[model samples]
Target: MSSDQSSNKKKNNFTIIKDDSTDGHGGYGAGTISLENMSSIIVDPNEDKAYVDMAAMHARSDVERRVKWINDREEVQGGKLYWIVWVTVDKNENGPYYAGVAGSEIRVNREIKRAYKSMAEHVKHMEKSLKGHIIVEHMDDHSKKLLGDFLRDYKPELWENSTEELTRQLF
Candidate 1:
């Protein structure tokens, strides 16, 4: 395969949903959080689109590439806003669903090679999503719609099985 294809394959691997690591085994990795069910969604309001970009799981999404991170949001003036949403899937009595969904804000300015995002907020959102919390209410309407459409189109069944709160908030 060509270099681009090989790189794409590697990027795709980040989105694979794995089986629970603990699985009630009570040994080795027991009591620890399992990220197997989680995926990252990158929402770009400027593009009016949302899509899964697993590399964001490590702050390496395409928009984040080649940028130095700045803690002070003011430093990244004119930076474009982006949302890194952490979505966790789990199966209930009905079926597999979007159990947890949280969106974190990020701003990037490629021209200045700087980006702004709170590491603490991102970490907190990821943890909340793992615990089945929905925290996208703070996102702008356009971004929310994009996220809702992406989720529904990505997996109709999952969207159907998700809680009404998710649909209500996103819509």
Candidate 2:
């Protein structure tokens, strides 16, 4: 596509925008064909507590033992099935995607929004308490996008870009 066409394309539809601080390799990070709501938080595996906790839960059930633990308070808050969605991101293309899903609902979209806020605080605590751990909680729609906008809105400088593996999972 010509430069004009490319710019026009971006204007017509939502596209993932990546800051080329690290490198221009964030191909899809440049933008995506899908709608913004369909975007996802491309997490850094190194910081993926979900992947780590699954390994720990097998041997021990302690919260300390688990890489990521659902808040007991939140778990018992909404309903019998309450799950929280957690995501991690890096500043560049190199990342490991980690997300946590809980079946619990806090009720209404507002509650879900608050739930995300609480989760963000929880993740900040996790990052501080756990050494060398990078954790972030961003809200993504069912398609997992503004997890991109969130990243952009929150940190325009830290662009992790998108991963092919993460995109493939969407299909």
Q: Best-fitting candidate, measured by TM-score?
A: 1
Per-residue lDDT tens digits for candidate 1, residues 52-130, read 8988887788988999999999999999999999999999998999999999999999889999999999999999999
Name the runs in model 2 displaced over 4 angstroms. 1-84, 90-105, 108-143, 165-171
TM-score of 1: 0.85
Q: Give stretches of model 1 more than 4 Å off.
A: 1-14, 17-31
Q: Which run of 10 residues does model 2 get worst, by summed lDDT?
A: 99-108
RMSD of each: 4.6, 16.5
lDDT top scorer: 1
* Residue 78 lDDT, candidate 2, scale 0-100: 45
